[model samples]
Target: MGSSGRRQSRRAVVVATVTPLASILGSGLLIIVPVLERTLGALAVFGAVAICAVAWLIGTVIRHNVLVVEPLKGAGSLDRATLLLGRIADATIVVAYIISVALYLRIMAQYLVRFFASSAPDFLEPLIACVAVALIVALGILRGFRGLERLDRVSVVAVLLLTFVLGAVLLFHDGSSLVGGDLTMPPVPRMNPLEILLVLGGIVITVQGFETVRYLGDQYDAVARVRASRVAQIISAFIYIGFVAVATPVMGLGTPAGADSTLLDITTRIAPWLALPLVLSAVLSQFSAAIADTAAADGNLRGLSRWFHGPRPYLISGAAAIAIAATVPTFTIVAVASRAFAAYYAIEAVIAMRTSNGFARKSFYAVLALLLVAIALFALPAS
Candidate 1:
């Protein structure tokens, strides 16, 4: 290939990676600092690493399936049991996407409302979220998502730039504070080991979007999709760990009443001038994520059922998100979405175990499947 051809190939991979990368960081980057600081305090960075590690392991399973089982299924070689499992996995992921759509818009609504009125009524957040969902669904129905899909690249680039800038500024601030003998780690509420584990499990949703690559087979070859998934996970893991490490020490001493906007507070304290930019990034990230997941859910539904063709899936997802946004607490929505995705991952692991060869690989998949099941069963919302 010529240099231009190589560049285009690289750009295609990057563009393929952006969907999952944006989905992974979209809402997680906004809420992780407060959630980790409140739960793990001085150990927050380590906790972030642990979550990323789990996410990486799960991503490995997904990549394995992409390379192994996908071919078998594609060739119509899978047995009835594995095919049944695949159907269930598809449905599970669709549900997860719907819940995530709610979680994203809810967080976005919090940032939007709080940006305008610090003391807005509780109802306003959900109201804004529902309205946004309506608009996205209407757009999806009337025009399709070709235009809104561009936001994935825009939001992902803006977020990566803003996040690195914030991390650098925070690290500089921390260094100056430490040099001046003024650095202090924030206090956190102590939790039992079980509680801690549950909280971590609940956070799986934060790093849950890598599976988006599995459904992109139409756009890219399996090799490209697998490569993109791995790269996205690696990049997101570093971003999550580094961001958490720098921001944890400067987080508020206790859980704020509203955890969704915690990053805004930290940014305001560290760099007031960056607050508006951060909020703008937050809005972009959240809305982009919601649109991605909404589209994914719609696609999955169509794949699973003939009845879900056209705009029906979009209408269903929009209605479900609005209902959840109105009825569920933000943290509770996070936990529920986490469990939903964990369940989907657990099912995918089973498919991997069944299709992949070798005792060692099968054992690994079995163990990971059990762990994911535990997470699905036990993950608790952060307080």
Candidate 2:
């Protein structure tokens, strides 16, 4: 490739790699923020960002160490414990994806009912999103990461643009609110250490997409993958911080019609003209994210079993996702998913430390400590 060609290729790789990560992270914020609010109030934004930074470090190390060129296998130590733990970690990730899709379906359904078609039944959004996801997976419409990434490039850009517009309007309307705001770290209350710990543990799920870097083993060199993953994490952090900073303060200004309607709530409060567009963007972004996640879950399923390594695995998995989405409430599944993911992170920390050496191993040890603290918090009673 020529210099121009090289640059274009690089941009595509970055976009392809980063956009799905961005989509997944953007969709996750709605669920993550509320969990944070229970413990840190507005400071949850900063806490979440801090966790992202550490997650980025830990994820990059794992990605570097666990390169998987083949879709069905990973490169790592061959001990039975390592292999068993690796399967558990991968299975845990698959479970997270499934639960997230169910939550997305419920949220999407609510958005459609409230904004787009008041007469539409509450079940419409999940039905449509589930069918779309099923068709895409079953038909193999998305060829691989590259295809999904192409779709995500558009989805992520639309999501970020609308989010920027919303944040800008919110900030302009309430610049004073933020100015007088003391964003200093608040002391954790002494009375409910257990309750506080669970919230802290849940915050770990906010940085869920960083591990996605491992899938790039086939398409990019190690250096390229590292740079791309780091860039994606930084972008996601700013996006999360920007939204939380603006949205959390403005939340009290207007009541969202429903729990899942934060984006619509803020946009309607500060810039009514932007609400529809924001809603549209959010729906599309989330739908795209659902597709990406469903695809990923199917891929992981195939990786885990030879019977699943066929044309119908996506169909089977996608149907299961739809079934789960159709039956469950949003937050209930979200809470379950968050706890499951926290467990995954805890296991992942052990795996990374066990398989690593030198500085990487030390870093995993530090992260392992953090994960343990977070997990212990979850074991405590609600404050």
Candidate 3:
């Protein structure tokens, strides 16, 4: 490849590798976070998100660029801090993904309840949520990373702006509501640390795409890519925190909130104008996330086929999408997706611990242990 060719290839690779991570994070920052702050209390949400941000910048972004590559000859650790910070991002994302899903369980339960109570549940729209999850997973299998990253450039911004506008409108109309509440919030023992760990396990799905950089290998300007990814991850973390920070107070007027009463719930009650559009946007977020997933799955499968020197990757990969769609019933898909995500993150954290630098392995293990405990606690009990 010529110099121009190499640069173009590199850009394409990075974008593909990074996009799904961005999309997932963007969705979290927007639609789900308002409730995160409102119900949890701004300070608790802020604190956890802040810790998450720092954890990600240090762990995943730095790890791959520096530590993962360093096992090869001639690559220096991104600096002395390489091993320590790198593991933090890995654990943070692993934990975050898990928690995101655990939180979603409440919403899924509500929808199921509603469906049961409704007279014409059979007439319900085909499971858009299921379609969304299968599409996302298939995208991961198909698109490699580049496809997802491209989707994120726009999808992330769209979700963010839409969410911000909806949130801002609520604050503008109901400024006084925010001040009337007690700053302190009683904790949901259900969402205690162990459960929180399980919930964050789904958040692991958000950071899944960053692993794409491993394929970039010798082509990347290692230090620079690490820096860029870390910056992106940190900025995303703070933005998520800030969003819930603003949203919770704006929605504080309602009956005490539950997991179902998150940012979207509060908005629907307080600002119908915002709610109507936002509900649509939430669907868009779901759809967009699914599209990106399909794209990623397609690319990955194609690459694997090539790596194994197999024939006609396109056919097999294309079929993979169809297969996912066919096998996973569209209606229960979101719960399935969330559950799958929880499982995936739990596994990833364990892998991260095994792969992390010495001291940081402890951090990864701590989170990993908590997730296992949560599964036994919440899921096993319910079953």
Candidate 4:
């Protein structure tokens, strides 16, 4: 392709990539905001923000400068730790999906329990997420990046319009009340700095979509993909922060009703018509993000085998995706999958960090190892 043509193509790639990623990240923050406000406290949530910022900066910088990121890394096993750079991107996607799915299921369950205490189940949400993961991996193995990108773009438009219209309604109707935050919050709730780090860890997972670019490394121009990935990451992070800022004050941290979507509920109060559309769009967006993340895991595995000297690790690339799907099986299953997806994200982040930094960074992996244990515990099937 000519330079002008390539530039246009690159621009198209950026549009296609950035929109869906930003949408996914925005949705993710909807979940994280409440968790920070309630579970970790606002002060503690900052730690999560700091950790995520540093980890992502390191990951992105390495991908852009130090590595020659190739999408199809397993092409010849050893020549491609060069390919491992792709992990930075994959780490971002997986982490966000897991965290978002967990929040989605958790929020839905709380609502369900209020209406039908006997019928509601906690574990079901993640199981459904896991099933979606399977569909995602299966489709990813068969389809190309173009198809996924198209899905993301379509999802982004539907989601943004739906969220904006509905969220506005909820905010205007509900947030204007002076007695609002007090309605759902405890008398003496407080925020700490440490728990904020955990919240930051959760939110960081939401903004990650850089890996998508690496998959198209060969199809699109390299410089464009790299630049696009960086831009996409920045845009996604901003959206996440913006959504949380807009959402937290309106929803109040103590209430689960406003948590999954503090913004949406506010809109529901003002313009209830927006509720059904918002939920539908929210679910669809989550599903699309899950598929995209699973595909990324496949791509990450393909990249990792290059250095492991493990005969190109084809099956391993698809293993987590497949196993996750098999366990959850369908949309009916949510809890297991959501938890697994979260676990996957945490693992991917630590691994990506470990791989990029020298062995001197080995100690970080140990810390990551501990973080994984904590994630597993927090996201356990029963919990």
Candidate 5:
């Protein structure tokens, strides 16, 4: 290929990568710091690393399926068990996407309301979220996300730039404090190993967007999708780990309130000037993610049932998300979404095991599946 062709190919891959990358960082970027600090305290970076590692492994399973199971199904070579499992996986992903739509809108609502009125009533957030879901449904029904999808590139780039800037500022602050002989670690939270494990499992939703690649087969070939998924995971893992590491030390400045806007509070203390931009990025990321997941859920529902044609899936998903946003606490919504996605990943692992040939590969998938099963069964909301 010529230089122009190579550049175009690379650009296409980057565009494909933005979808999953934006979804991964959307709500997670705003929430992960607060959750990790509250759950693991001074050891928060390690917890961040652990979560990113598990997400990468799950991404591996998804990429494997893109390469293996997709072809098997395409050729009508999948066995009955694998085919059944694939159907189950599709249903599970739809549930996960619904919960995530609620999650993204809920978090976005919190940021929007709190940014305007710090003491906004609790009910206001859910109301705004419901309104946003309704808007998405209307748009989906009138016109699909083709135009709005363009926002993914803009939002993801803005988010990545803002995140790296925040990370850099925090790192500089920490370094100056250390050089001034005033750096102090945050107070460590005392939780039993089981509690720690449960909290870890619960936050899996923070890294849940890599699977978005699996549903992008219509837009990109399997090779491009797999490449995009892997690249997105690797890039997000580094960003998550680095942000957690730099921000954890300053967490000692104040106790995290365990709310969706906790990161905003932390940023206010360190870099008040950056707070507005961060909130803007939060809003963009969350809304774009909600759009992506709502569209994905609608598509999956259509695929699963003949009755779900046209805007019916969008209406159903929007209604469910509104109900969830109204009734469920934000952290509980996060855990529930995490478990639903974990269940989907577990089933994908089983499909990989059934279709792939090597004993080592099968054993690897079995272990990952078991871990995901445990996550699905035991993940709990952070208290």
Candidate 6:
């Protein structure tokens, strides 16, 4: 490869590894932890996180190596009905990603207002977040993949470092109010099989964005992409464990009244000084995730139609996503994102089973069966 080609490949690796970390850190770890604790209990939440880490690693490896088919590919080879379904499924993935991004931004905005500017209007927070996301998405469209990668590199590192520090502080803090018990070790939750299944379904938000690599075309070879994804998932798993370890012990710390920003709530109780950094990291991660998702959406759309085969398409898709997000309720967005992921996984499993050889084929089928169970479990109301 030429120097320019090498640079693009390197950028592709960084974006692939770090882009999903934004979502993993933002709403998935921060906002979802407390909710999981309250509903499914901490044991179930931890089990789900563990299951997701393993499942994502296996599923990603399979998808990258054998099932590397882009849903909209083979348009001429497939029958009309199958091709149409493929397009619709790919389209759903794009739209589901946007909804997830919008939902995370809305949550991040609430934290910003609550912590930094209590006097700000309720709509103002989300509006500002929407504008920031729009600008980031616009930058990706204008500067292309390299610019987005550079931005994500800086933001993901900062968020990861800040998150680690925050988790450590909570782990070591001596304050009775924050620690609430012996400082030697925090309490651990016990997991059951059923709750584990529930968590398997719930972890879609954390692991969903990694699949965007399928849209990257030939930017990186399969081996490199799989390696990068494994590295990313490891880092993401550690971060998830760190936050869950810190947050679960303090589950008794009061919820943040109306908003769903649980990690923020815990930080406020234990270490008020860290609140600003957490908020900044959360917001930054949301921005990176939104950019990555919009870029993926743009790439997918470009695959399906000439009308979407240019830079402007990214901005259009992103704007539409933001508008839909701003208009829909957060719960509705969550519902759409979860269902879309389940459907996407099912479709991908079918594709993988066809392409994979003996051992790999069996593994794909096993994963597919688990995915079905997780999908069904994920649809149930929290009890």
- In order, candidate lDDTs are 0.89, 0.62, 0.45, 0.47, 0.88, 0.62
With candidate 6 superimposed using the best TM-score fit, by how many Å does residue 141's alpha carbon deviate from the native?
Answer: 6.1
Clash number for each model: 0, 2, 49, 34, 0, 0
Candidate 6 per-residue lDDT over residues 26-118, each given as its tens digit = 566655665556444545346546646655744553354323444324434445654555677677677667667677677667777788787
Stretches of candidate 1 exceeding 4 Å from the true structure: 1-8, 254-261
lDDT of 2: 0.62
Error of 4 at 219 (Å): 2.1
Candidates, ranked, lDDT: 1, 5, 2, 6, 4, 3
Candidate 5 displacement at residue 61 in angstroms:
0.7
Which lDDT tens digits does candidate 3 get at residues 245-342?
55554444334554333345566556656654555555555455544444434444444334623334333433443444444433233333444444
Collision pairs in model 1: none
lDDT of 4 by residue, 255-338 (tens): 444333243445454456665665666566666665555445545555444562332222343344434433442221233333
- Residue 376 shift from truth in candidate 1, angstroms: 0.8
Off by over 4 Å in 3: 1-21, 34-58, 65-67, 70-126, 129-151, 170-175, 178-193, 200-220, 250-262, 303-383
TM-score of 2: 0.78
RMSD of each: 1.9, 4.9, 8.3, 7.4, 1.8, 5.2
